[model samples]
Target: MNISWEEIELYLRHTFVTARESKKNVKRVIVKLEDDGFYGLGEAAPSPRYSESVETVKNFLNEFNKLISENMSLYTTLQMLNNLNGNYSAKSAVDIALYDLHTKKLNLPLWQYFGLTSDKIINTSFTIGIDTTENIERKLDEAHEFKVLKIKLGCEDDIKIIQTIRRYTDKPLRIDVNEGWKNLNKAIELIKYLEDNNIELIEQPLPSEMLYENNRLREQTTIPIFADENCKTFEDLILVKDYFDGINIKLSKCGGIFNAYLMIQVARYLNLKIMLGCMIESSIGISAAAQLASMVDYIDLDGNLLINNDPYTGVICKEGELKLINEPGIGVMKIEK
Candidate 1:
């Protein structure tokens, strides 16, 4: 088997907003593994907020590919990859692509190979980035097709934003702070203020810049706090075990389906609420995560499908429910190299 990698530029149909920032573009690293003339692909979009550059991730992948291609088995490959820090998304993409090939070689559906057989579909929350109260309300009114609404709210004047959104609908709602809240005291205040109105949960309300403080903050909120940035890999799981009520796993963050599978088992044992999230990639990445969502507790894998301008295929987000294409080996059309 041989592995090859490429940096992909996926254009977002529109600017995506979060509490900490907004983006009007797309960038990704797609890892492709070829063996016996068959190919498997996985993608990850590197974010500057995570202090990652495309080249940094690519160079590391090059080394990983080089080392693994020298005749290392998957287990050995995993050990080498785990020894590195950061680059979780890059590693995840490569891991996913490898699994894609492995499953395809066996002529099996990925879910089956992973020992999952449920036809359970997950209702994903459509995310509305940090926007004006009026715009958020407008989007909320238009979001009749979704069952849940997840708004990004880690900034100044967050109270007004949550208050405005509450006035619009009483539906189940969640918020991703994106490490925007500066302190635990502030995050606690924000969660308490929004709890009764429409807040179902708060994610990463405290900043991840400080592990001790972030963990300390999670203890103060009654509404469950999910660790996103702080819980990138299972190894980091121990650091956040006491601080977070749950952990959000993004295929991009965990380095692919294989490692993500491992994380789920460990998280379940540790009693962590599992959430599956996504980056601004195409349907390919979303489908990979969707396959795992049915086995987890929360699903936030709608970022790609929710864009008004996604011109790819694989998964569908309708009626707030995530539906996979139901094809084998990720059910994706290969990106033309």
Candidate 2:
């Protein structure tokens, strides 16, 4: 197998702000794997929140190249990833590429390989990043076609922000506090206000470490709470099953599709709902995540949609519904620059 990679910057259409930080653009590493004349593609959108960056991903890939050979199987590669420390995003890039290469060799779509169907896939939520009230209105207008909208909160003026958003439209809304809220009482109070509004769900209201606070807050609110930062891998799910109602599984954060696939089974056994998510990535990563959309309860795979320049095209989302293509593997094609 031949492995190669290059760093690319993706400009966001809007300033993507979360409680932790803000970003106008993001750096990503596009990884390629070639074996027996078949090529597979993947992307690594490393997040600083996870102590990962472009430099870290690149360094991990360099070490990764020395660990495997042409005779290694996909299972072997996945098992090897467990031995490596951290760098889930970097491991995810190689993990996705291997799955793509393996699936293509068998001439089967990724979902088909897992004995899943696209019919159960739900519409994704278009994110409205944290911005000024005026900018929020503009974002809302632009997302008119989308059936659901995810509002990013965690600022000092969260109530004012949601109020500003409610004035614009009454579309179904999901709130992502990004672990912004601190006090359990305060989170409970905010939940009351969100409940009166069109909020369908709340994500990470308190900090990731506040497991007891989250469980207490969950008991007070009727709305379901989905864990994002708190739930990174299958192991994290076990720890957070009693804390959150559902888990937001992002491939980059969880280490790849295979890991995410295993997570779905474990989450179900733990009686937790599943929400498939992604970073601010191109279609290569988003499409790879979408292949497992059929197994998730909610979809937040709109990372590619938020970007202005996506180098690859796959898994078209029309009015929020992700249309998974029938092509072999993860069904993505690079666009010529």
Clashes of each: 2, 0
Q: Highest TM-score, which number?
A: 2
RMSD of 2: 1.1
For each candidate in the order shown, give its overall lDDT on alpha carbons.
0.76, 0.90
Model 2, residue 301: distance off in Å is 0.7
What tens-digit string does per-residue lDDT give for candidate 1 at 1-337? 6877776566554466776677877767777888876677777767777777688778878787667664556567667777777787787777777777767777876777777853787888888877776777777776778888888887786888877876777788888888888876776677778767656677887678676776666566567888998888768788777878889988777777877888898988888898888887777788777777778998888767655444457766668887766566776775353
Instruction: After superposing candidate 1 on the true structure, give the runs of residues whose Cα lies further than 4 Å from its correct spot.
Output: 68-80, 83-85, 209-220, 306-311, 334-337
In the range 16-77, model 2's lDDT, one tens digit per residue, is 89888988999999999999999899889898889999999999999999887998888888
lDDT of 2 at 58: 93
Error of 1 at 185 (Å): 3.5
Off by over 4 Å in 2: none
Please state the error at residue 298 of candidate 2 in Å: 0.3
